[model samples]
Target: MFKIKSEVGFDMAHYLCGYEGKCANIHGHRYRLVATLKSETLQESGQCRGMVDDFTNFKKALKEIAEDFDHKLLIEDNEEGRELAAKLEVLPNNFDIVFVPYRTTAEEMSRDVFNRLKSKGFKIYEVELFETPTNSCIYTEE
Candidate 1:
């Protein structure tokens, strides 16, 4: 198998609603995401000959995902999330809120990114999202 990896970084804040840990408090992370694409054989014809896929294309797809989350607050779609949205909205040009269907955890984010890139026609093999420089969650599908 031929595999290539690309990475991008984004800054975002999130809180775990209803959790008792310190993570329940709103905090930010400079998250780094790495995406791996795999192919059984490299393209033998075309501009991308002998390549699994263009690394630039992979970075572009990742940049799209990064832009959506950069400098934004990711909130879980629930009661508290709604409340936070309301409060932030009142601040006018102060906050950018991004609502997600589930808790804003690295595990969920890895899966979400994996699906998103897959839909974009990438032969995605895995997605790894880092909550910190050393802590990360990796998602893959067989």
Candidate 2:
């Protein structure tokens, strides 16, 4: 099998609702994500022969996903999330919010992004999400 991967990084802030510790408070991280794709076949050409696939297309998709979350608040769905966002909205100006269908954890985000790429008919092998420089997680369907 042939594999190709791409990565992107961004900044985000989030708080875990209903948590028992300091995690309940708002915090931020410089996040990075890596997406891998696999294929067993490649186009036969003068410059592209025997390659997995065109890495340019994979990079484009990764860029699109990264742009969606850069410099945004990664909010999870909960009473706290709603209330805090409401308060922020009432400030002098407004900030953009990125809401996940589930908690704003690396695991959930990884799975969500993986599904999104897969739904687009991409040969997604895995998604790796780095919530911190030392902490990261991966999600794969197969």
Candidate 3:
């Protein structure tokens, strides 16, 4: 199979509600995301001929995702998270707030990114998210 990988980095904050640990408190990470795409055959026609996929297109898609989460506070989609976001909104101009369907964990973030790119028509092989310099998570369909 032909596989290509692209990576992007972003800074964001999040808190794991209902958890009894330091992670339950808001914190930030310099997140690094790597997306891998694969195909059994390369394109034989068009400008992308002879390549599995255009690197520029893949980078663009990854950048869009990174920009959306950059400098934002990511919270779980729950009543407590909503309340927190609402309170933040009333404050003076601050960072962006993003609500995710799952806890703001590296594993869930990887899966979320994988599904998002897959929906955009990419044959995604996996998504790797680094929550810290030494810790990371990978999500893929086998």
TM-score of each: 0.95, 0.89, 0.94
Model 3: per-residue lDDT, tens digit, 15-89? 887889777788999999999999999999999999878999999999999998999999999998898888888
Off by over 4 Å in 1: none
| Order of models, best lDDT first | 1, 3, 2
Can you write out model 2's per-residue Cα lDDT over 41-107, one digit (the tens) per residue?
Answer: 8768866577765678778888888888888887877787888889888987667887776888899
Structural RMSD, model 3: 1.2
Cα lDDT computed for each candidate against the true fold: 0.93, 0.84, 0.92
Q: Name the best candidate (by TM-score).
A: 1
Alpha-carbon deviation at 111 in model 3, angstroms: 1.0
Number of backbone clashes in candidate 1: 0
Off by over 4 Å in 2: 44-49
lDDT of 1 by residue, 5-101 (tens): 9999999999787888878778999999999999999999998999999988889999999999999999999998898778778886778888999
Residue 20 lDDT (model 2): 76
Better of 2 and 3 by lDDT: 3
